[model samples]
Target: MAFEGIWNVVMPMGRSRELVRFSKTDLLSSLQIPSERHLLVAGLETKNDYFEGIPWIVIQHNLDVIRNITISTGPRTESVTKAVDLYLEQIKVRGNKTLSDY
Candidate 1:
């Protein structure tokens, strides 16, 4: 299998959020994953006939409050929380134009 394994997704439901896990087959067959709220895709694990790996952490923010996000990979030097904190600073500097417009 080229892409076979489970995909764990964290999404919002009403007031709080929930983590939902989906099989690769199910996702591919249905071509659907929850998209009603903002998402944070981190730590993807994939397995096939040959090898198993965790290549990247993809972050997808679906709110108009912030428009941009960036991350660095390869050779971890600091704690994950610290890294995220630094990245969040970008949003503070950039300012929330989308919210202000409203």
Candidate 2:
């Protein structure tokens, strides 16, 4: 199946024992990034799990596209912003390329 559209993303970072939840509506509401071209990556963090620095991933529904979303425990705003950028870049690189090129 083709992967497109917004998706809920959740990721953990560092050793913080907290869960970060992002709703699909929240992603649509964000003005900083265009929701139409973004795939949301959000999830809950459990106490028994470790983020391993790359706890969160915002990948498209399509297996061909793999985007990395990094969630930070210190300043949430900064981390989220960075994740957005990373997502966008991934989309551009993966989606914009031709299948035969790979």
Candidate 3:
């Protein structure tokens, strides 16, 4: 699979912020795995003139094994958590183990 593509996303989380950066084929071989659906979550620390804080969650998904990714923020609230909740709900309903589970 080719390794290319970038997506920047932002979601609302109370007064805080949820942001994400996605990339492809960056950490596959080291993990030693075949093509499959994958999701990753991480936290980011940042300091700037405007803000000084850490984005404490990130989530990423490999949509068919041909793509890789990185997500800098995931769910962080009760009212809403972006598309991840729907995705996880789908997985749960379908009885499929998520990437984190694997």
Candidate 4:
């Protein structure tokens, strides 16, 4: 039995590759991992024994935001929060402009 794993995802604006774990969808013929945010970017999945994948349009995390918030008990929480905020801002400002007029 084979299992899905993380793959190198070239950051949109940066020249670095980030490893993101994604699963192959049997129904959608896509490699996507659902999230609370409205959207995300999915790169191509080439291990096509079962199905081929496509580069999906990025979107926002949807549903309950509070439930998605991580519950970590530590002093470094503030730093983590700041880092996440920065990432979100980067995505919001730079992520492929889905709605051109929006």
Best by lDDT: 2
Off by over 4 Å in 2: 1-67, 93-102
Task: List model 1 lDDT by residue over 8-27, tens digit each.
Answer: 44445555555545444454
lDDT of each: 0.30, 0.37, 0.29, 0.30
Best TM-score among the predictions, by candidate number: 2
| Every model's TM-score | 0.23, 0.28, 0.18, 0.20
Decoy 3 TM-score against native: 0.18
Shift in Å, residue 30, candidate 1: 12
- lDDT at 44 for candidate 3? 13
Instruction: Name the better of 2 and 4 by lDDT.
Output: 2
lDDT of 3 at 101: 33
Per residue, candidate 4 scores C-alpha lDDT tens digits across 10-37 of 2334355554444333312232333212
Model 1 clash pairs are none
Q: What lDDT score goes with residue 69 in model 3?
A: 32
Clashing pairs in 2: 3-62, 7-40, 8-42, 9-41, 9-42, 9-43, 10-41, 10-42, 10-43
What CA RMSD would candidate 3 show? 14.7
Off by over 4 Å in 3: 1-62, 65-80, 93-102
**Model 4 alpha-carbon drift over 4 Å, by segment:** 1-74, 93-102
How many clashes does the backbone of model 1 have? 0
